[model samples]
Structure formats: structure tokens, C-alpha cells
Target: MAKKRKVVDAKRDKNGNITDVLLEGNKNFTSTEKALGMTKSGLIDLVVVKRKDKEHLRTRPDGKKGNNLDEMADD
Candidate 1:
């Protein structure tokens, strides 16, 4: 089964980039790479996309902005 928890929050660096994300039930933030790994392993519900030479995680399309990576980072 796919993971039910979604990224509800985020942790960012001084550059204002999201370095980590917080799951629905997780109190501590998890690295984006780890989350990406989980997404690859079918443990978490996400998509891996290549941008230039790097892979990034994105939420499945649901026509909602609340769960978008950018909004989550604003929290």
C-alpha cells in the first residue's frame, strides 16, 4: 500500500530552499532525498521527476495548491 502521509510542512536552508519535509504524523522533518527514496520504493506517494541533471520529488496531481511543495515550504 502507498503511504498515506503527505508532506504537510517543510524545513528550508538559508537560501530559502526546501531541504526537508515533515510528514502528516512525523514531528521531525525528513530529508528530501530520503523522502524521494521512499517515493521510489513505493513507500510514499510521490513522483520523481528529472530537472536538468537532478531528480526532485513532486506531489501527485490533484488540482490543489495546498499540498504543493512551495506552499508546504511556506509553513
Candidate 2:
């Protein structure tokens, strides 16, 4: 059997962009923070990455490729 995909209820803005998402059931806040590698204050730097085949590419704050285009980082 194929694995089921989890669905989330999203809140969008007037432009049809996702602003927030909610998952089902009650989850522990501490556990969620720990799982996301976030502190209690929820302060972290995020990097948006795109995938090209098996390689993951990093994007800059402006959503463009940086000076080095050879997969800077990965999870």
C-alpha cells in the first residue's frame, strides 16, 4: 500500500498566497519547537532551497542563486 499524504488547512491572503497552516490534533508546543530545531523565542534564519534532480540548490534572500552555484548546503 502507498503511504498517505497528510493534509493541512491553510490560511491564505487576498492574493491567494499561503500565510499560515494548521495540522490536525493538538501537539505539544515544546516538542514541535524541538522537532523544528527552533528555540522558545522562535528565532532562526531560514534558507529556501530548490532541487534540480538529485541535487539541492540554495537560494538567496531575493530568491535567486548566490555567487557559488554548486549546492552550498543540504539537510
Alpha-carbon RMSD, each predicted model: 1.6, 14.5
Once superposed on the true structure, which residue ranges of model 1 sit more than 4 Å away at CA? 2-4
Which residue pairs collide, candidate 1? none
Local accuracy of candidate 1 as per-residue lDDT tens digits, 1-75: 654567778777888777898888888999998998888888776788999999988889999998888778874
- What is the lDDT of every predicted structure here? 0.82, 0.29
**Which run of 10 residues does model 1 get worst, by summed lDDT?**
1-10
- Specify the highest-lDDT model's number: 1
lDDT of 2 by residue, 1-75 (tens): 323221123334476433332333424122222322322123322323336643221222554443222322111
- Cα-based lDDT at residue 56, candidate 2: 23
TM-score of each candidate?
0.84, 0.27
lDDT of model 2, residue 22:
32
